[model samples]
Target: MAKAAVLVASFLFVALTMFCEEATADYEGCCVSYSKYQLPFIRIKGYSIQTPNDYCDIPAVVFHTIKGRHICANPKDTWVEIRIQQLMNKVKKMA
Candidate 1:
């Protein structure tokens, strides 16, 4: 009986680990942007969100363009998350 219980517990542990891993979708250094009332806001990774007028460093990600140009705007503030790899590449290119 003790051996059976141990086997069941091990099986459950392995199943749970696999399930969790499968549920996660991996994106590197990406941020989700949204609009409100024709205003734009962004959230940057590793830093607090700020107004569009305030300058902050963030990794590059493709976003929707207006009139074929990119314009950062503020509606209520933005949320951005940048990954370490993307940020590192930007620095390397700058150097």
Candidate 2:
């Protein structure tokens, strides 16, 4: 009976952990990225054009979606790294 209880508890723990992991955001915050050439082309469905450019680092955000499928790229050409850092800071403060 004790072994069965332990097994059930372990199973419940594992299931709850997995559920929470799935509920969490894929990219909750922003980070400085030097190159975005390798990232898959994600369509910005709901997000507006905050900053537009054709280069490595870009500034963009997910207006609504939380999963990887909704996050989009901004493609800022000049001063991308700096701008992204600033945006990340602002987001941190707001959060």
Candidate 3:
């Protein structure tokens, strides 16, 4: 009985680990093209700048819109940089 329980536990651990890895892999290199009109709201919930990493080398600015969508924009884009600054300023004020 103890051996059976250990085997079950090991199987569950491996299964969970594999599941989590696959879920994270889905987000790897997941930058979507930027389109101003497609987004439903202008308000940004959050933003993040992802630098060059092992998986993806290109820098990207990810915008989290109020409608719970992740819009990835080019960091070099003038409009994107401007928007980032604006959002940072808003956060500073709130802090």
User: What root-mean-square deviation over C-alphas does model 3 reach?
Assistant: 9.4
Better candidate number, 1 or 3, judged by TM-score: 3
Query: Each prediction's TM-score against the native?
Result: 0.27, 0.27, 0.55
lDDT (10s digit) by residue, model 1, range 2-95: 9999999999999997764411111332223432222132222222223222233332333333333232323233332323344456668989
lDDT of 3: 0.64
Off by over 4 Å in 2: 22-95
Worst 10 residues of 1 by lDDT: 22-31
- Using TM-score as the measure, the top candidate is 3
Q: RMSD for all candidates, in order, please.
A: 14.4, 12.8, 9.4
Model 3 Cα lDDT, one tens digit per residue, 1-95? 99999999999999997764311112654553444432222567877766766765556677787866567777777777778777788889999
lDDT of prediction 2: 0.42
Question: Model 3: runs farther than 4 Å from truth?
Answer: 1-29, 32-41
Please report the TM-score between candidate 3 and the true structure.
0.55
Give per-residue lDDT, candidate 3, residue 92: 98
Ranking by lDDT: 3, 2, 1
Clashing pairs in 1: 29-83, 40-73, 40-74, 41-78, 42-78, 42-79, 43-78, 43-79, 43-80, 44-80
C-alpha lDDT score of every prediction, in listed order: 0.37, 0.42, 0.64
